[model samples]
Target: MGFATKKSKRWELQQLTWTFISIVMFVPLPVHIFPFVMLTQAKKGKIRSWYIAGIAFLLLELGLFASFVYFFGTISQAMLLTLTGSVTSYIIGNGLLLNRAKPYLQRLELAEIRPLAWIPTASSRNKIQQLPQAALDTPQLFIERLIHWRKEIDNRAIHQNIDKIIHLFQLLEQNDKMEAEKFLVRHATVVNVLMKYDEIENSRLYNSVTAESKKKLEDVIAKAAIAIEQEVTNQFKSGILDVSAETDVYIQSLKNRNLLNE
Candidate 1:
């Protein structure tokens, strides 16, 4: 099995084990809340596992109940416990399943909508070991960290931001703002690198980028982030910019004006 599939199966086993325990204890009280939560989350698969465990418990309880009644001539308090436990197990098991699935579900939805395109690819093994220790501003530092950890980042949102940043550079180049285009391209390379790190693993290089340094770097990027913003405003004022055009179309238009170096 794939790593993800194995991990998921392990998680399911854990959940089943706990659900079984709750069943034996006659306190699947979470059933009252988790079922409704599962419904709202719309993740029914997880709830199905809970039902599997609950049903198994119910079957076992029925066999035991029959034995007790046959020997003792009465359906004892165990019957009451079984009835209540069964009800709560189903309800709460659903809720627990949905709750556990929430983050994965949200990320899956986002991945569907934001199709991956033209993300610069490089291996973390190629990362440079040492960086110059000279004084550098926040944007430069942030970009440097990106370059240093280029192989470590793997977040979709960061790549999306890089896409926008690339588009902005193309826009600047089209507007004869070659200097700004070059500046951002040089600085934002790290942003792209950091964004493309492995999603499921911790990046040692990424972890090394300190928070205080990141905050300062963010401030710098924000201030000089996209010089194309001003150029876009100018184009709009001059009636030269097509506001309705999709970003890709505009990028194509700019590329047609000048060849973008790979």
Candidate 2:
């Protein structure tokens, strides 16, 4: 378990390092984005069906009903033809863009963004073989892969490693706690103490927090293994602190297990 923790921390540091590098090189995007995600719906485009429909009706009416209006002397026919032309053009453009062109353009955009290439080409698209071994072997990459595995374990309906142990401690949702312990060894006490949100008042650690003077310290542990204390606290204040609880557990558990004697 101590070995696991060391490996995970090493992996985390490598990831943060790479992320900082990528930001220095690549176009900027927020490291965290859930709050801004909801803002996506707020943006409205300039184009609308009413405009297209109006164009189509004008063109078609001039060709079709204009002649009829001239012969029959009924402006009503011209008006009907104009409306039809506008609607038909709008429907055609909207259908093509929404159903066919939109998806194709998106696929092209994704392919263009593939590693080591700014202008996407066929060879660059979805090419995993080009990645360097060092990039794959980096601690950050390893930790991300570990997280993926942790999720897979969760999906299998069993509790194993730090994830399940934390789940058992949370006591917030319906889950087979005993069943999880059947598959994995849960030895991380830090996680257990952190998850005791209800029992926070009873814990000495909870009472010791200086910044949180008024509210009972909400005992918590994030499973994402985030290292930066300030960043984690900011996320907590904003109400969406996604982090790794097991990172702390991994270290403390290692010390307890005598993996780090000093």
Candidate 3:
């Protein structure tokens, strides 16, 4: 089977396991077991797991309601408890747990670098061409691609510098400076250099010429990483100055209005 098919099957199996556990454990005592299961699944960083847990909870609740109505001939109190539990679980799971888990999940996804599937004889040109244009355009996608490239290179120094560059890009994106024209140009330039390095390192003919080109590209990559770091530092410094100026203006206004002591 293909990679996507394998991945889908794996997810299905996981969901099935969750469904079984949730129903088996929760059908008897939902109040005690449901929240625990939800919390556990939520921490796994899979939103689908949450949905599976919820559906199982509903099935359990339906079963309980039926049992109550059949035995006691009244579901008024049982229904009330069921409604309260469902609402509480929804609020706590969806509003609180999922919200808290999303950022952590996103970071994990961003940090994961998947390997490329290609023959060893594939040309560097073909390898570079395989990279999607969309990946290079978006900051998050570009960072992921950079991580994959970093893994391909065996140099420790290059790895450290690339890690710094990736961190800086993330910082800039958090500060909303990723789309600035200068930064965009710099990002594109760094990607180009890395692509060239990937090409040189993976070339079939590794003579002195390729070796020299590889060394030059490594130096260029190191320099580009440093430049990106410096750019991020300057951007942060500018933000600090802007915040300080605003704070000073606010303080002055407050003093003029006697809202604060001079």
Candidate 4:
């Protein structure tokens, strides 16, 4: 089997083991352990919805246990409770997953609609040539191409930075995350508007695009580009300053130990 298939099978086995423990034990201890495992998996972006339902089921079971020292009931009653609780938890988990899946599907659709110009390969030039002109002219494509033009930096670093920003946004469901998402949504809207304008100009509706509309679109693109450049410059400057300071401290320490000449 492929490595990815093997890894996925392993995860499936782990989840099954925990689930069996939770159901067979019919106790809060095994139930709680499964939820914690699911939560860790969710944080790693594996299973997204099970943790919340598992946690709810665990808490309910714990409350029942607190009321009764042991499951002082008939075997049939215990089995009934386990079956009901497990079914309820499964329904709740599936419901939450469906809710999240909607936005996730929409995002995937949007990404497909605005495909990147650069493929991670030596054949990127041919791929770009094959794309429609509208895709080539998008602000997002422009930014991606510009970053790719910098041969000195590894492209993976850019992806890593983007992942870090995404991780930060995922850390909370509060106002900060909302505000950050709002800013990104607004930026994406602006870029899409510009891309649509470009498409119209390139299409048979070129005569319909008024000069004023064209000017406004150009202005928006220019301002957005300037803002992006400034942000990148600031980040690079900050990194350089930090490195310089650290280097100076190291040099001073070496001089103090007579390990280096003035």
Candidate 5:
């Protein structure tokens, strides 16, 4: 969705990219930037209307192309066209970058949902909400529903990839130590690991995946939630996913599967 090639040092590809960025910045893209940023704001999250943004951006690009062809009909008008091109590039760039930050914001929101102890309950006291009846009816189906929640916080335009990946552990920590330690012992093996009892304040996952951004993000988070850094951050917990809270979700998920009561 993005490219950051260096400015031209005589190469045609670089030159072409530079020229394109210029033309695209000229008008519609720039004019759209303000509205686009405003549209991204949410009372609880960053914007997530990426499909709509993509469609609108496509139309804007088409209009710009058609206009360029029509108004710059004469080859001699190249200079004036270049000026217009620059403006177009600026607006488009702004819109796209703002859009990209939405996912990061979502990740931050997810990050905020830590142990109740870490979060002050003095304001809006959140509760140990019960499983929604809908989720209570089908465990497997809802278990995999991780993407939309990710999008709500991480919808590309919000947070950095590092922070997003860090979320897996935060969820893991809450799952194992804070809420689900017992359930995990019954339903899973990882929860019985000795490191599940500590109360870590900050989160720190492996940051070694420097080869590719996407690969790095997935690999680090997907790796087992065990490490000296994670151990320290978790307040030296003894295990992975706690069996108690794990059991609650497991049972609920099973109830969701028609196995037990909600």
Candidate 6:
């Protein structure tokens, strides 16, 4: 019953499910369930779902070809049948799946999980160049980055702080876009700290020094969250926007952190 244990079990179950699908796809002319299963997985934001789908499709085709050859007792006849079936299935199945998964695929492209420390400078340069300049300074980009980072980081406190920060930015985007941009500009160090923290976390060299650096980074992110909450409250008090009920939760959190006077 720990959260991590539950997450691990869930992930294992998913892998097992995929494995079962692959086995089923290997059966001769198996039911076309893999494509539907693939679309479901892709919609859930699983990055490698397409890869699994492609491999399973190939297995399915191979099984069909083998079975056809065995039944017909002729390579030429089997080739013809296999070719027609596979090409037709590929065209129809993938067309529908791709159409349905387009939005999820685009979102995944925006926040592609990257190993900051492991990527070579030359390789990363191309990736950096591909991003829009406006996106670099946007709260949405940072939120996506933090979401991906949460998947890699194991600390629950860091996860909670990240969630809070994400919520604050979302509220700012909805209530006041100008204020959200100003907050990002004012707290530019938040971006730098996050980049440095990611580098250290992915370095895979856990030592006392790295541990201390991580602790400091966690504190920085927590403080940054507090600052963001304060900015939202300031916006509310200045008549820029009415204070929503959710803002009350943020104010309570800040007070719990002892950053706001009771």
Q: In order, what lDDT does every prediction score?
A: 0.42, 0.33, 0.57, 0.44, 0.36, 0.59
Clashes of each: 9, 16, 0, 0, 65, 0
How would the candidate models be sorted by lDDT, starting from the highest?
A: 6, 3, 4, 1, 5, 2
Clashes of 2: 16
Q: What number of backbone clashes does candidate 4 have, counting pairs of residues 3 or more apart or in separate chains?
A: 0
| Alpha-carbon RMSD of each model | 15.9, 22.4, 13.1, 14.4, 17.1, 11.8
- Model 2, runs deviating above 4 Å: 1-74, 111-262
Top lDDT model: 6
TM-score of each: 0.26, 0.18, 0.50, 0.31, 0.25, 0.51
lDDT tens digits, residue span 22-121, model 4: 4454334433354454444344332334445556656765654543445556566765676566556555544444344322232222233343332232
> What is candidate 2's TM-score against the reference?
0.18
Runs in model 5 deviating more than 4 A are 1-48, 74-89, 102-262
- lDDT by residue (1-262, candidate 6, tens digit) is 1222213445444434643553345333444555555545444544454546646666675676666666675568666877678666656555545343333333433333321221222224335533434335656546555665665566788788777877777777777788778866776566566667777878998899999999999899899888888987777676644445568889999999999997
Q: Model 2, range 57-137, lDDT digits (tens) per residue?
A: 445435544544454654586666655654454454334333322222323222232212222222232232222222232
lDDT of 5 by residue, 1-262 (tens): 1121112233423323423443444454323342333233222232245435544655565665666666665655664765566466556655554444434333233334531122222111112111122222221111212322222232232223323324543455454544333322322322111111111101223344322443433334334333423543564353434656687787788888898765
Candidate 1, 75: how far from true, in Å? 4.7
lDDT of 2 at 222: 34
1 or 3, greater by lDDT: 3
Write model 3 residue lDDT over 15-113, tens digit each, in one string: 435434544443334343544555455444334445456567656556655654554645577667655665555444434333433232332344343
Give me the overall lDDT of model 4: 0.44
Among all windows of 10 consecutive residues in model 2, the one with the lowest summed lDDT is 37-46
lDDT of 1: 0.42
Displacement of residue 191 (Cα, Å) in model 6 is 3.3
Higher TM-score: candidate 3 or 4? 3
